[model samples]
Target: MTPDEPRSRLADLGVGPGAFTRGRHNAITDVSGVLVGHSTVHTDRLHTGVTAIVPAELGAERRWLPAGLAVGNGYGKLVGATQLQELGAVETPVLLTSTLSVYRVADALLGHMLEQPGYERTTTLNPVVGETNDGFLSDIRSRPLGDAHVSEALTAAAGGRVAEGSVGAGAGTVALGFKGGIGTSSREVPVGDGRYTIGALVQSNFSGTLSIAGVPMPADELVSAPPAETVGNSCMIVVATDAPLDARQLTRCARRAIFALRGVGSDFSQGSGDYAIAFSVGNGMPPADATLSPLLHATLDAVEEALINSILMATTQVHADGNRAHAIPLAAVHSRLAAAGVI
Candidate 1:
């Protein structure tokens, strides 16, 4: 792997240095009240897990969190599109499971929510669930995940340092032909005349020709031999912020994650369905009732920073099947930057 800074978290990857800032942990948890949890299932045959992202606030009427969605490619599945599109808001936690396990995970999430004291009284429920393929090293057809796993992940989540690399759903995945799974990063943006936080968590399963910032490199020289393309891959990006942005604006920010992914050498191949979702944990001040032009610009800035953090923070991983993928090295990256006159 390229020797950048021996970092396992995305924030340490070093992007747009000395300008935009980062949170304490350089994770989506930097956004106040955002909590993340994961349930990984790795056996002799199957390897996969479920990651749950809990927004600090819940319900359509709760005026603390505003959210948005961006779909780069629609070939994949997401459970809450209709409600999110209709009301421009989400009321439940965001869950990321394998492609075929969406329904089971969603049901489990809803059931888990009902068990909570405040959530049971609610009439309607909608849990946002996203997924990617992990069939390469995992026996996906086994449906390793169940209600208990989803509930455990959701209840166990808390805001703070989030573990990465094989700890969660990313456990059995691959990136650019190497072992890939979950990666996270964050950025602090100037807001209200000061700095506010925005961060991202990504399930990195996309494919490419294996380049660090578009500079093609030999595989064995850096990461282990690339994996066989059994199934086309995809990614699910979750952006979290304390900035007050409506759904449309949050979506605009979400799509910009592609820029950061590309900067890290992801080409968004044909089979890759790069999807992103953004949420604001700030007091969900209504757009209809409030007027602030400067806040909009601040929101945009946060989105860009948050997206870049996701890639810069991700590190390489090795899976149970004896397959390994290394993070793009920084030493080689420096040479490429100087050669391209980018430095």
Candidate 2:
């Protein structure tokens, strides 16, 4: 937000938007200890790839954490979620890719892990994978995701900057009649009795409907053209926190992401596959202990912040396919808000 914007143009915070509380960078990388990597593929016939999210304790091997998943729509494929849920732990990186390419990424992930000097020799590994449909701009039939791309994503995973819009798996994604791709945001809540941070990242390829805090606004009122149909859009949300929480508590945090999603006008359409995964650093909880109240509150604050961040800093991205999906154009959106006396 400190960056200067052209007087004639408004900044794109995410899918459909006007303004919300945003971090200094307004990106998922704003979350402490969260790293993001993108493998973008653009060729004569390819416009999709993968994104890897690493929530490690600065990439240390001994840093174990609790994790959980929530599947809003099961129409899409997700790998390793069962294990993550069963064990309440996520020891590996999470990869997001196009539909029909889950197995390829999973296998590549395994290989990537083994390639590490003491990978399997030290411990068994399990990778988390999530995806959405990209058949519109990509040759989804070709199954373009391969080992090289997956490996690149893993190797490139690092904390700091995260590229959004029309990159990685979002390169071929469409939302709300316009070109929609990746978006991210973060929120900070007082840790308790107060301390710690919670953040969120979203591979938002969901449908476009105009809604402001639950009130529907016709797309035409904002953008010149609205997407044709709102069907088949999907979104993948990932929440990461340094707070200590168990698997069940993490799952609850992941569900909060849907609330912010609805604020941005997502109806969780028929063809949409909305899924969330939440992970937390151990904080002060002992690995052997099964119950801790202080650690539990940390997770609740994280879930709340993570969901809000997913909707804040996402800017609109236009794809090469000639599709332009704009998150409520800032100017029109602000004007509409003022007219409705909501701003």
Candidate 3:
């Protein structure tokens, strides 16, 4: 499929009505004031880009948002992770890009924040940047990303439908033996007399047996085994919510997001860097422990759908060296799910 072709999401295929209701857009942007943008850098040999997640309170009236991190494998680079954990907050927009370009992206993000109207006297700032290796489909060692790409993404941030598949940092990613990219989903939960939204966004580039709704893809239908060189890769998950959850609660939400990978069949390989970063933009008193169950359940549902969407929405990509990663065959997948009565 061409990069511009419209892609289908898990919901469009009638995959679920999980424990909670989905937000209007069924995307992370469904969380109030959360915006997402992408800057794609696609060329013959350079198929990488950047994605920026800008929270509402990040600009002139900048206020640190409560945030938490959970590491599943800890084999990839996540800048500002320690500081985020230590202070239980995020002071800048989160950025995602290729592994080699992470440092450059981080520097650019730092610059972007420092230039904000209220930061004229800023001394120290922590910019959170996450990455997943895209070496197999891109010339990763060349480090193609630059400040311009970052600025483009940050400037384009918007709170509506998010563009998925082979765009942004997901441009050259591979997952479950198929073409992989960016994906997102959100859920709405009712607690006390109020309702909250939990959303998830994922950059899937790891290896695994493709599974959908508890049904695994037949071995014969596999898109050939994942290339040996790309076997142990990684996945980055970001969770956002408008729920009044504290840092500790957000950390729990992050862990639940990581566990959602099991439903999609990820093996969590030794070299895979699986991580989940969760942050809350809500205010007022946090919910009681008894009321937290629905939030956790919502986290699991949204994250699983987001992971699946990452694979389903991806288009086939060909590397400069002639190696290719094919998109999963939707027809076959549907048949499998039907045969198993999962649809």
Name the candidate that leads on lDDT.
Answer: 3
lDDT of each: 0.66, 0.63, 0.88
Query: lDDT by residue for model 1 over 47-120, one digit each (tens)?
Result: 67889898867644462245677777776778987777677777788898887777888888878766767665
Please give the lDDT score for candidate 3: 0.88
- Compared with the true structure, the alpha-carbon lDDT of candidate 1 equals 0.66
lDDT of 2 by residue, 4-103 (tens): 1221211242233222334455455666767888898866456688988876562345535788787887667778878888898887788899987878
For candidate 3, the clash count comes to 0
Model 1: ten consecutive residues of lowest lDDT: 9-18
Off by over 4 Å in 3: 1-6, 218-232
How does each model score on TM-score? 0.81, 0.79, 0.96
Tell me the tens digit of each residue's lDDT in model 3 across 1-343: 2342456788887787588988999999999999999999777787789999989776767569999999999999999999999999999999999999999999999998888888999999999999999898899999989799999999899998999988999998888878888999999999777899999999998877878898987433655545323533899999999998899999999999999988898878989999899999999898987888989999999999999999889887877788677777777777888898888
Query: How well does candidate 3 match the true structure, expressed as C-alpha RMSD?
Result: 1.8
Judge candidate 1 at residue 312 and give its lDDT: 37
State how far residue 231 of model 1 sits from its true place (Å).
Answer: 2.8
Off by over 4 Å in 1: 1-7, 10-18, 59-64, 192-194, 210-221, 227-230, 284-343
